[model samples]
Target: MAAALGVLRRSDEGQSLSGAVLLAAHDLLYEQVPFPLGESSLCRLAELLVGRGVVPKSSDYEGRWYLWWPKSGRGPCRDCGKSRSLTRFSGRFGDDYRYLCARCRATERHVIAERVEQLHAMPGVQAAHSAWVCGPGPTGTRSAGGTEAEIPSAQEWSEYATRLHEMLSPLEWAGFELPEEWDTDFDRRHGGLLFETLWRGDGGVGVSYHPHEGKVVLGPFDDVAGQWPHSYSLLEDSLEIPVPGSGRQAAAAVEVAAGQAGLLDATHVYVAESAPEEARQEFTTHRIRRIFQPAAEFRRLPLNELLRETTEDHWLSSYLDWVVGRAGQDVAPDIVPDAAALGVAAWCWRNNTAVEAHHLETDVLMARVNIAVTRLTRQYICPVEGIDWDSIKDALMDPGWALPDTTPIHSLFGEGWTEVAATVCAELDRWRRLDHERLGAQTTLILMTIGGSTGYTDSWWGQGRWHSICRHILDEAIAAGLTLPAPYDRNGPEAFLADLHTPDRLSDAALDWIIDLRGAAFEGPRGLRMNRITRPPRHCWDPFWHSSTGV
Candidate 1:
């Protein structure tokens, strides 16, 4: 073919891009039995096709090549858009058959261009060399490198003092000019405020607030070395911290983040030492108040016994420090000899009853120790690995899909989980076999996921909208399943009319206990979650909920 095209010198008339030429070219490409052609021969064929007026030029054959390559053939390039695509069709019947296209074959890496400028009249003296990461490459992957590439990428600094602030407002907190002494190892060595989070740095590795290549970019890699690492997001994949409000709200934000991350303990607890005493006490008590009683102001609750059980490195140690010694200290109370201590004793011992009947001789330290243990174990234990807890929970739900662990505390005393497992297996067998039960569970999952809720909500709810949150609580009796629609309130807004009956009887406390089972899966009760998000956006109904009514 090259010989034939070579015999005919470049013809000014070439070939008119006519129907006959297109018909001939199409037939040559698609109609004939597939056959082999050498690279040299292929170029000649392109020239021949050009001479026959199929394509008018060869200077940029690619511009038109893409328009025609979809000739349904025996072998086609699978990865066309990728850099290392295999669009090569050798055309041989059996030996070489993969095909690659012009665009992918033309892909190239960015070249770092360099231009040297000699200094003084002095021999061999050098001023500097300008360098930049020249583009026409894949994307904004590599940093604009080289010492002389002075075009600062508006990404090297943040205005906020902490990583927490930078994340909330990345736009306002964007890049600032460097101090210009950045040539040494200093940038990577310190990793302090300039580019890193003030206090969020964990063992010198902090996250880059900027998203890069759809990955969680990590590093302070020596800019000179120019190598950085990226991982999927958790803290980098397994956990994601929400863009909670700036500064002081970090603790509250992390409280939600930790549970969502399925973590054993809160990973990032940001309460500045300079925070107020009231704030510190509030932070400490907020945790205790979630599961324990006396949600308001209290001097302290005991921690010494729990402290003895724990070591210095325990995850709770630093948090416990704030309220540790404060417990056991005496405060005055009327009519009782040591009523101040009694109040502390009350939080540790009170489980369900409204009454406080511990003896005057009640061991407050032991009682407080028990409370501390329950706080950590029952309420905040990490999500257990390999447990299809949802399945177990489904088995426990009554037909109404009530919350589990609703039994009086005493009822949970003697039975082991083995019996529960048997019941769960039986229940799951029953639920899965029933089409409505299975589909209802799936449909309930869909409603909860009005937006992405999967990661934060258990696969269950991450990938869900940031606003949509689901928390799973586990109770002993009430196996929280799909939320039946809230019972119609005769006195509700819908029932608003002139002649109203007395207000609906359920008090706020009663409503709390009643709704507590709505999303119970395996452990402690996480309180009501709505716009306020009190208990870390709590509860995902059993995957199988017969939602006859609205939630």
Candidate 2:
């Protein structure tokens, strides 16, 4: 009964009785009965099947692993297609395993090293340390190659002078000429005035009065490399700072001013360090009072009013308001409002709608709409305006516009309208009229010469407007005496049919005539003649035959 069962279960390929019984047991235990078989037992069954040729052995190093027929031999090695080989390897014991050939590995390493060297030699990174230490001075002080100077404080210098029994050392100062273009009024009103006094060790620092805090705060001086990095540290440590007004009164005034400026949600206001301690304390207290207020109740504006205020040259606030308004319009519908979605939509509309070259997907959609509008206006609507839509249609349908069958020109443009399509079409038409005169020029020769693989697939060509325009131009050229031989044809015919067409089997004489005519057109007019080739004139249009056959 066991032998009969094995025979009944045996595969069509003639496997042994034991192997057939094992496979049946495997299928019954794992799949039929739904009893879970452990990995070790599964592997053992796989080995038995592989030994019986019911499955394939993938590798000898590992125990017999089953290979299904469909998935086997599908992968090809990068180096050679003959045998399956490792394409990637993990590192073992700190040494990297390589699956690539020795030559390819060496080439890859050389490329990586060159890129690394280029990065290390970049100028910005090389000057980082020197630029950091020098601050905003005209020149950096030279020190020993590997050593740096210690930064000194103002009190330390004064104390040292007093211990030496010397009068205070004369203040050594460096003067920088401010450009006339610098706004003096903005400087005075904001805090640019405080930065004018160049303290001995102080690099670049600016000051601004905080109206809300009624205090003067130290800000940073703007240089080519931007604000001084150490200004924050100085602000925290400075003593005997100037105080201007009351912080509570200033904060109230700022709130009123912000409301007028449409900044009702303003949260944090900065106070100047030079402001009076009383005013600073009051401003801090007022901020604490508003700590539990809902964020939606107020708008947050940066505390530096002088910087935030709009001038004719600076319209940041107005622009921000416009952006916010647009965002509000887009998010009025969805159940769950997403700020990021609104921002992305706004960005796409602004960037894609206004600029020509900036036309991305949104711009393409807009252009398609524009083209449809233009066509509709010309056809159904332009007649009311006394424009001739019929004439335009007739021009498009003219015999002069008909293209060749062999030239697959329509496959170049994408499906939708491209912004550059009209311009490209006009250029192609101009070239078609000029022909030899235009294409003889170096620039035109470069444009017309088709040498390298375009790498564009048929699907890509089928979808674009530019592809269709290209097809139209090529077809038009063929109709207007520009004969391009079919790309697939080896032995040229006067009219080469596509491969899918049934051959008509022309008479010997007619076939000879076609071949001769095509050969002459290619070799004589195009200057692609081969030596020791002779042909009789088959047609008047055949330039080579005209010279050779003299018919």
Candidate 3:
């Protein structure tokens, strides 16, 4: 048996078969040497071994490997029951060990193609053209999916040109034409003029012309009336007439007056032939008023003209007051509780006192009392609604003053004012803990909310003006010869407190820190009223510092 085993290992065919079987079953244990193999070579080896009666084979088992043949032809094919011919089948690899037929591979490819087709059918995928996908051509190339590119055809370009002309036709109808003397090719060369639509409330469309580089712009009007005199004119038949009169006049006359007041050196003028001198004078007066006074001031002028007349609801009156004056006594009464709470919060912030929950409640009450006095002083200003007074007072008394409520006053205080104050205070506290390097970034965010930043352009809180005030305060503080504290990596609250009292360099870094403190003080619940009247004795700290000193 040993000599036969050695002979089987030495034969070329026997050696090749043994090597292939061993490679296939390398992981199998020697005790499990009779395990099945499915490859063709393994079947040939099985035939060789069986011819020598090394393993049993049934008469029904033909070219099957000995490992795959059951002793009684009873067990399922030792390779797998699915294998019909042991010589024809081989095991396939998968996520888990499984026997796969050739048929399953073909099905996977079909499913992938169907999904790709569905994705291409989505909306806008075909409608939106990208130049990258459609390479440049005289007429842009179409996409692989057969969608036309955005490249415009000659006919389409002509139609777009026609539409542009149609849009501008009304301006031509109104005696305003694109400067005809210039080249027809000017638009092509200069990328065309930017056309802006001017809408009239009276259901008219007007066109305004701005030249490529010219300063003078012209707009045509049906009537010049009370609008800017220097900028508008009414065309007459072949002659230019200046509108006549003063004080109260026709629209054309007012235009002339406005033009004259503006001292415009008119190279051209359009005038109405039938305008009365009174109309002309009024036009000029309105123009003068507009030219000399600011928009807010001009709007508030107590003129009884139709155009200058105030609204019935006193909207303009309230708006002007809100813009130009401090919060009126009546306005304060409406939001007194919120304003008071904010004041108390500001007080606590400036003094470095903990803004505990109880303090917020007590300060709110105090704010209400103060607001009530202001409201009473302005009692004659407007009729006091009984509910308005009671609601405000009750809201102030309530511990949950900052909580959301359905009433308008509650909405304003609980939602608006409280939110702004809370955000400001929180931001201030956040920066107080940051190191000096992050001070500027935090200060910019805080000032942005308070209108202290450059974005405060609307004149809404007098923010631009306040920014100037803040700059001046910083300048004074820096000029006082203060020294900066040594830089630390991670300074905490105690370090912040120490820096506040210590003298510091008045660089952008120092200014940002001081501005934050001042901004917090300004936004604090109590309003600071500086007495500009009294002159402080020598050795006085800056009034701003003293006023903001919390006490």
Best by lDDT: 3
TM-score, predicted candidate 1 vs. hidden true structure: 0.21
How well does candidate 3 match the true structure in TM-score terms? 0.19
Candidate 2 structure lDDT:
0.27
Sort every candidate by lDDT, greatest first: 3, 2, 1
Instruction: In angstroms, give how far residue 378 of model 2 lies from its true place.
Output: 54
Write down the lDDT that model 1 would get.
Answer: 0.26
Question: What Cα-based lDDT does every candidate model obtain?
Answer: 0.26, 0.27, 0.28
Give per-residue CA lDDT, model 3, range 494-534, as digits (tens): 34333433222223343334433332334331111231111
lDDT of 2 by residue, 91-112 (tens): 2212232243323433443454
**Top-TM-score candidate index:** 1
- Error at 16, model 1, angstroms: 99
Model 1: per-residue Cα lDDT over 1-551, one tens digit each: 33333333332246435435443444454324233433333444444443332332222343344233322121223334332213222221122222333232222100100111111122533111111111111232222242222322322222122222222222111111112112211132112222342111111123433211112222321222212111011232433333222222332343344334422111113334454455546444443332122111121333443234334534323323422223211110001111111221222223212213222222222222222322222221111111122433432333332212233222232243344334434533432332132222222111111111111222111111121222232122224343322342334323221111111132333333333434455454443233233222221111111122321
Q: In model 3, where is the ten-residue run with the lowest total lDDT? A: 533-542
Runs of candidate 3 exceeding 4 Å displacement? 1-127, 130-194, 197-551
Q: Measure candidate 3: CA RMSD.
A: 36.0
- Looking at model 2, residue 395 earns an lDDT score of 41
* Each prediction's TM-score versus the true structure: 0.21, 0.14, 0.19
